[model samples]
Target: MSIYTIIDADTHVTETPDLWTSRAPAHMRDSVPRVITDSRGTHRWVLAGGRNLASAGMTATAGRGTFKNPPKTYEEMHPGAYDAKARLKYMDQMGIWAMVMYPNVGGFGAQQFLKLNDPELMLTCVQIYNDWQTEWASADSRRLIPITSIPFWDVAAAVTEVRRCAAIGHKGILFTGEPQYYGLPLLGDKHWSPLWEAAVELDLPISFHIGSGDMAEGLVKERVATYGKMAAFTELAVDIFLRNGLQLNDLLMSGVLARFPKIKFVSVESGIGWIPFVLEAMDYQFKGNSVAEEHPEFDRLPSEYFARNVYACYWFEQTAPRRLIDKIGVDNILFETDFPHPTSLYGDEVHARIKGGLSDCEESVRRKILWGNAQKLYKVTGPSADDEAKL
Candidate 1:
């Protein structure tokens, strides 16, 4: 039986080689995503146009030592990364009651689909991934919450998929922080209004994960090349942190939150420390700048909307909980493990790390950060009363 009622807000699932191929229709099978070995013997996923997506090594890193030496093949990775049954065993050992799982090769928000010129293929890929995710989560539906992705290039299609996935028990939708990179409308653009409305009406939170958009690719590559593997990893982490902050600012300033009051936005894998500063800066800018004056659509300060609708997750952060908890608000802060990623809080250490981070807070605040907030945000009722008591 587990001791902690924990919910991981930003874990990942390394898709198996056949995740898309097996589910694709006969006519589309040839064009669906499949694995191919490069000349160097590295396993990389190849998309429709023979565009090579990232390798599995980049996604499956749990139990492996150091970012400098990630697993180079599917055979070297922990089974929990792609196998739900194996994941539940690991979850039991870690005492995590539930986890919100994102994609790996699918580019977090499945943004890689945008690279496909065939819109029909792209939409089919999205459906296949979501169907596979649903099947994986079925291994233990109460504990594994699958987040679905959509074709952001088409807002109407996105809305349809959002509704479809929600009807099948998906808790949230994973989307790119910046859709403008794909020549699609930005989050604040009117084209996204229907999607946002569908999400709001469906009671599904729209989650924005760092690196899900195109903004970080160049910087990540540059950092990795300039610095060695470990240093490059550190630089990427910092870069993602800053990018999430910018995304938050964009959504806030865009007046989307103000417009859709009930819709929630989660900044996944983005720590909580910077949130206070962003909120403060947003309020300051709203008061001091003419942007707010020119756009009177904002009913209140950006911070107000953030406090009400925005959420941030922290996996390995300690200082944020200690120093900025009150400013960030316990309700606005959640917890994550980033499981199976290079920098995850995996194995027995996860409990110790999370407990140590929350040691300074009141028990109530700790409970909220650990599971209470997630329960409310994701609408997780947990296992049945009998099942929970047994655990």
Candidate 2:
């Protein structure tokens, strides 16, 4: 079997109750999000309305058997859920040298923070969350990289938070790609300019990750609420694709990309199959006078800007990576293992999955998708071909 060192761009872990209560400042930690596991080992998030966001349906097991519910404690997931040494053991087993982690409950926490009405409270929560991620990544200096969440409702505060995350050693910022904050359109507002400018200046890529708890509804409705959380999770993967194209179109048409040429934008967990059609449409639209008149700064077409400034992360089973590399360019494609998700088992299974999908001719292309692209994106130094070959 041909071998390669994988860098999973999208592995995730849920937060346990003790995360904030034990690690955060006393007053804030007690009121922070708490985790609940059922007798069956099923896990869910318990928040203000007594709402429980279920995790993978099953709970934590004592060792390896399936739990009736998800594990109630973080320790059940790993020695320290964010500990680097524990993660490195798993990484070596899986042939992964590094991973970037997103928050469990913090996916929806940013939206809730926006609703709190006080910007101070919103900023504080974001600050604490970013700090937690920094500490978690620092636990294993070499293997884990953390991504920070943005409080979009407060643009200036959001810029401050992005810079803060960078200063504290975070790799990037995560946003939901929603324009409105509780029915208000912050899309065209000038307030977000600083946030965009900060990202450009700090050299941090802005990632639009799908599937926050309470998402904006008007854009796309790919699923219903009846089928439980899986419906939402499936729909989230679709929503990020739909809204990213919409938001990217807006940014390009509105001159955001032109204004911030150096800023890189990544659409994560959104499969790659849709790129050709989207790029084709934009290229066609720009050829006519329609797109040019809206923004004079756009000298090249939308596809050119996309190739220059944007990238898409392909999940393990997706068709996009193997199928669309030539169209999207190998440099713009990256690999991700949605670790601990229903689809991916967090072990050596990832190696088989990657090797199984890559064609012989595409081996070089696969290397870029699996590691090189991410190395460039995260600006982290990793093993060279000769060094990796020796493994």
State each model's CA lDDT, in order. 0.84, 0.65
**Global CA lDDT computed for model 2:** 0.65
Candidate 1: regions farther than 4 A off: 39-41, 48-50, 216-225, 290-292, 385-391
> What TM-score, to 2 decimals, does candidate 1 have?
0.94
Tens digits of lDDT, candidate 1, 232-279: 667767888788899899999887887889989999997888888889
Candidate 2, RMSD to the unseen true structure: 4.2
lDDT of the structure predicted as candidate 1? 0.84
The true-versus-predicted C-alpha distance at residue 330 of model 1, in Å, is 0.6
Q: Give a tens-digit lDDT track for model 2, residues 133-188.
A: 77767756456878878887666667877887788778888875555535545544
The superposed Cα distance between candidate 1 and the true structure at residue 366, in angstroms, equals: 0.5
lDDT of 2 at 349: 60
